[model samples]
Target: MRSRVLGSVLFGLGILALVFAGGLAFVVAPAAARLPYDMERTQSVAEAPNAQFLQITNGVAKVDTGTLRSTVTVQPDAKTTADLEGDLDGSALVWLVGQEVVRTDTNEVVSAYSTSYAVDRQTAAARDWNGQWLDTGSNRQSVKYTGHMYKFPFGTEKKSYDIFDRDILKAQPARFVKTEEVGGLETYQFVQEITNGRQDLPKDRLDAILGQLMPGATSGSVAYANTRTVWVEPTTGQYIRVQEKQSKTLVGNTGQSVTLLDALFTYTDDTVAKSADAASANRQKLLLVGVWGPLALALLALLLIIAGAILVTRRAAPTTAPRHAHPRHAADEDETAPIR
Candidate 1:
């Protein structure tokens, strides 16, 4: 009776454990995969003014260009607004607003870029950077951030992407060049290379535009290229640091490439620190939900199953016969022999 009761208790506990494990594996785990995506992320980078490009006596010289700062805001797109409530579509939208200030004057609008992306809510892979609200040039097809938004399951040997260049006004390839540490977090470094790419303007049109900036008479087509490097935290898919090396050149009738504007952009130290903290926290949460927590639950279920099996075996019927199986068999045989 004790064995039977113990077996019953163990069996019941084993079933409960299996149910819990199943719940965690099938239901809770899937929910956790989508957790990091449902929030609004706002980040701002400071661009300090430098005197390096101020005195260029080439195609374009800065007369009174002041400090320029840009703000980028990203958010989860609303379903109703996008008409993407169905199973096949989801999006994240961002607004890029740049402001320039001359000395102590109020901020003046420099440029604005609005981008929408079709991203998988669960996986965080962006399928497409759908529409551009205010694209300044005709080469709209070459835009950046086209494919997967974040590195899903991030550890990659090389991550490749195509991003739109604001300088060249086209999309180009950016690939992982190396890995480095930023803000106490290991990160992937990617570079976007553009070399002497054609611009949307005609030669005469470009000359007309450059005539205003340059002090001398210029005649030729204008072309531009840029190199943008970024350090991204893999776990959270956030950029901790960024650098842009851009230059515009005017190819005169003599095929000379004169540098018009050369500028570099970098992120503030505080931005890297904040991004690192957020990424570290995200890594901890992913480890708990996707790795350690499931492992623990599986271990508990295995233990319950083993205990139940042992108790059930103990409660099973005996397989062997008794030693004194026929104690009365001798007497019955002897009585039968005498009567014969």
Candidate 2:
């Protein structure tokens, strides 16, 4: 009886554990992968050495060569996300991003701008709503932003993904190059390149370069191109390291060209270390809950169920009763009666 009770208790507990395991695998894992609302961190500065860029000196646009640094910051917009409705309330994360480029040698500001965009928390894809530029040539322009901009989705696959290009103001396909390791963590490498894509400059900035760069040029254009590469941790979809080669050219109405920018920038060592640490920690947590925990619980449940069944079946099986012989007198009387 005691064995039956213990077995029944273990069986019930095992069933409960099995249900929890399913919930963790199917439900909790997804929720755990979401981007937190308070992820407002400033990234480390990206630096380019021996870079050439256009700079204005005494009201003249001319080419200058120096070291350049790009600083980026991202913060969650509390006011915007607080009022999200319908499918966006719990599913979307609104972020404000700002970029500043400067010449490190002369301490001259090259460019600065800010933008607002919303992305799905799960997929990290930009949505159409709440997307517009600020303080740049494209300020307040209606932009049709699509694809992954800031981060990749969790469990990133070995396939091409659309990434938003800032200069082109559109999404372009970033092809997977190969699998690589970053700081002892496995990651996927993706490469994106843009060739001769035209970009709009502020009217004043464009006007200054028209006659300065080319003679007899009224309407001019700026062509932009970039080759971007990133190493992203697959489990958390966080970038461990990144590099970009950017080039820009000024085109006169008669097709005369002048080089505006030619630079190759890479992430700082500190940034890569921080990213790798974060990814490693998150990856471990996800594995514990989704894979290891569920598997262990399932195994325990099987063991408990089998033990319970064995105990219950043994108790329920039929057994023969033992026969006993009577004492001397009773045996003699029974023997005579049995003969008749």
Number of clashing pairs per prediction, in order: 6, 0
Candidate 2 wrongly placed segments (more than 4 Å): 137-139, 315-340
Evaluated against the true structure, the overall lDDT of model 2 is 0.84
Q: Compared with the true structure, what per-residue lDDT tens digits does model 2 show for residues 115-137? A: 78888887888876754445563
Which residue pairs collide, candidate 2?
none
How well does each candidate superpose onto the true structure, as a TM-score? 0.69, 0.89
Q: Candidate 1 on 155-188: residue-level lDDT in tens?
A: 3336776665644555676798998988888888
Where is the poorest 10-residue window by lDDT in model 1?
95-104
Overall lDDT per candidate, in order of appearance = 0.58, 0.84
